[model samples]
Target: MRAIQITEFGGPEVLRVVDLPEPVAQPGQLLVDVAAAGVNYADTHAVEDSYLSKSTLPMVPGGEVVGRTAEGRRVVALTDGGGYAQRALAWEAMAHEVPEEITDGQALALVVQGLTAWHLLRTCARIAPGESVVVHAAAGGTGSLAVQLAKQFGVGRVIATASTKEKRELALELGADVAIEAAPDGAGLKEQLIEANDGNKVDAVLEMTGGPVFDASLAALAPFGRLVTYGMASREEPTAVTAAGLMGRSRAVVGFWLMHCVTRPGMYREPMAELFAMTADGRLKPQVGGVYPLTEAARAHTDLRARRTFGKLLLDPSR
Candidate 1:
């Protein structure tokens, strides 16, 4: 089997293609013939050993895959790791059969990015219809889905922020009521966010970019508003928050991690099925920005970290 291996912690340069033996499945695990692997922001972090959890050395760095079992059932599986290969292992419980109506890339997108978007809106933000919402990085994978889901859930106004003009346009096409530039270093950001909401603070925010973006998002929240922090793509720390400030405004700063939801039954499965149904019916569109061959894993990471791509990125192991 051909896989992308990282023997040392660094940047995308560390992801090297190597020929390795096939992995055998253990008890309660399934061996999958890899078709496509989902590349996520977390994978970039994992490769550099800077993720929420420590990454081991000499490892393959993919978390979600859409592939087949020995019995020929097409499924989307969440691997502990090692998804960037021609063959990989998955826990039987974690694998969900892919619907015939969904493409391999679509199924793979719904695993990590899809679930995170769903939980961030439904669980963490507790979003209510007719409320104003903000989705940062609106042209990216989770952001694109979050934008659509917010509208589906009946949000009054959806404000989307992206770094490029084309990205902002894509967000509007996905149903955002307003699209604005995500200025670097929070330059005029809070004002732009407030201006997008018709001179009013927003009701909820789905924030991932940390540092200045996070600070601006927090400042733009309305009274009793909730801001859900999921990822720090900027790799910069945000300003610290004190309980006093939150209490004064009756605001909340909640944190969410998809790994926590994966441990609890029904949390992941129910929403994933809903996402699949939505995608099948054409209500939700999973944007596959780019697909790279298995050997070009380094390029994929480079594009992702550099914000040179949009939507969900995939790796075709068969290539």
Candidate 2:
């Protein structure tokens, strides 16, 4: 099997294609002929030794993958390493059924980004109809699905932010009522968002980028609003928010970590079924941004880090 191996923590060039021995499935795991592998920002972070628990050197990189399992059926997994290869092993518990009607490549897009979006809105926030919601990075993986789910759940209005004009338009196409340019200028971002809402405020905000953007996101919320902060894409270090910031506005600040949810599969089972049905019915759609042959994994990482693509990035390991 050929896999993408990271021997050091650095640039995309560190992802080397190497021919390696195939993995054998353990008692509760499957040896999958990987059809497609989901490439996430976390993959880049993992390669650079910035991930939560930096992986050991010379590890094959990929966390979430959509492929086959021991049961000989299509499924997705939150498995570690091994995914960026022609064949890999996955624990049975970590796999979710990938609808037979969906293509192998499409199945690859559903694992991480789609599930995170589904879980965050439906599980964490529990957004109600007639309420407002905003999804930052609405043109990217989780952001794109968050916009669609907000609409599907009957949220009154959705606001999205993107860094480029094309991305802004992409958000509107994905069901965001309003889409605006994301700014480094926190005050300007807040003002632009406020203006997009007819100067009204949102009932819920998905703040993926932490730091100043988190503060600006809070300012855009309505009283009693719920703000969910998940990623640290903006400022790598922590940012402080005073208790008064939440108390005076009657708002709540909560953190969402998908890894925690992954640890509790029982809690996510029912929702995974619903997501499968939705995807089968053409309701839960993932924008297919780009696909790269497994051997060219380095180029895939380069494209992602350069912000040169939108939607989901997939790896065709068999090719």
Worst 10 residues of 1 by lDDT: 239-248
Clash-forming residue pairs, model 1: none
Candidate 1 at residue 295, lDDT? 90
lDDT digits (tens) for residues 87-132 of candidate 2: 8888878787776787765666667787788877887778999888
Candidate 1 per-residue lDDT over residues 244-307, each given as its tens digit: 8789888899999999998797888899999999999999999999999999999999999889
TM-score for all models, in order of appearance = 0.99, 0.94
Best by lDDT: 1
Off by over 4 Å in 1: none
lDDT of 1 at 100: 97
Backbone clashes under 3 angstroms, per model: 0, 0
Query: What is the TM-score of candidate 2?
Result: 0.94
